[model samples]
Target: MAAPAVVRDLREHWAPASAQEFMLDDVDLGNRRLTIAGRVRPLDDLTLKLLLDWLEQRRSRWPNTANLHLLIHNQTADTTGRASSHWISAAMRGQDAPLEKLRVDRQLEEALPHGPDPLHLAEVFGLDEKTPMRYADSARALMERPLETDPATSP
Candidate 1:
């Protein structure tokens, strides 16, 4: 028999995990306010995208020297409230190492200056929105409900 469909899946069940590691501390982008989702658990696409934009924007505003510093810097913690400290550190030290680190940081800094932020990373990468619930409450509220159209009722 086919495996039971994963019950809640990413879209239905799953709550955000609240840890200091995943908390978004202070992210200020001029007059524009970015809604931070998944403070408690892994972030969804909307959250990740906004974060990438913010980080990249910051990276760009600085000179090449600062960019280089970011490339070499080992981030034990993300004061930016973007991701868990462990994830951030791992990503920094992961394969492609400095390049990956630079890319992530650059993404965040670049996103900071923009308005409305970009669509979440999930939408971009085509990943399932299987994020934990930490952001769900907020996400549900923010997203517009799809309008239901009855086929029997002609437009």
Candidate 2:
């Protein structure tokens, strides 16, 4: 199946620290969903296909192991487990600025045009309501700025 433009772009440019770290379980794939930091979300078709491919490759390499963990360094318990945040951060260093920055920027950008609905932003981004409220305040401040061309019409 053809991937979406955004998915294709991400696949081509950004390689995660460990592809396995982002792996999903059979249940998740079956439902075409994901749960991150306790937030359940739907997985797009392209992402689900990519995940299945990765899982197949991993299974081929270690057919005897019973490890159900998505990401694994080795078949042994000592090495096989989830990837660390530090490792993920390091991997993202040269690829882009901190992942948090990218996430915040995307969130703020999305909030800006829509008048910054804190509840919506929080739900969509899986962030605390306060976080979105902070960005909403900033967006409101920017909107309050007086336009040079016509101060009365500004904001």
lDDT of the candidates, in the order given: 0.33, 0.55
Poorly placed runs, candidate 1 (over 4 Å): 1-39, 63-155
Please report the candidate that would top TM-score against the real structure: 2
Q: How high is each candidate's TM-score?
A: 0.21, 0.55
Error of 1 at 141 (Å): 15
**Model 1 global lDDT (CA atoms, 0 to 1):** 0.33
Worst 10 residues of 1 by lDDT: 1-10
Q: Write the per-residue lDDT of candidate 1 for residues 11-97, one digit (tens) a residue.
A: 121221221222224233342332225222344455445455545754564324222211112232222233332333333233444
lDDT score for candidate 2 against the true structure:
0.55
RMSD of 1: 17.7
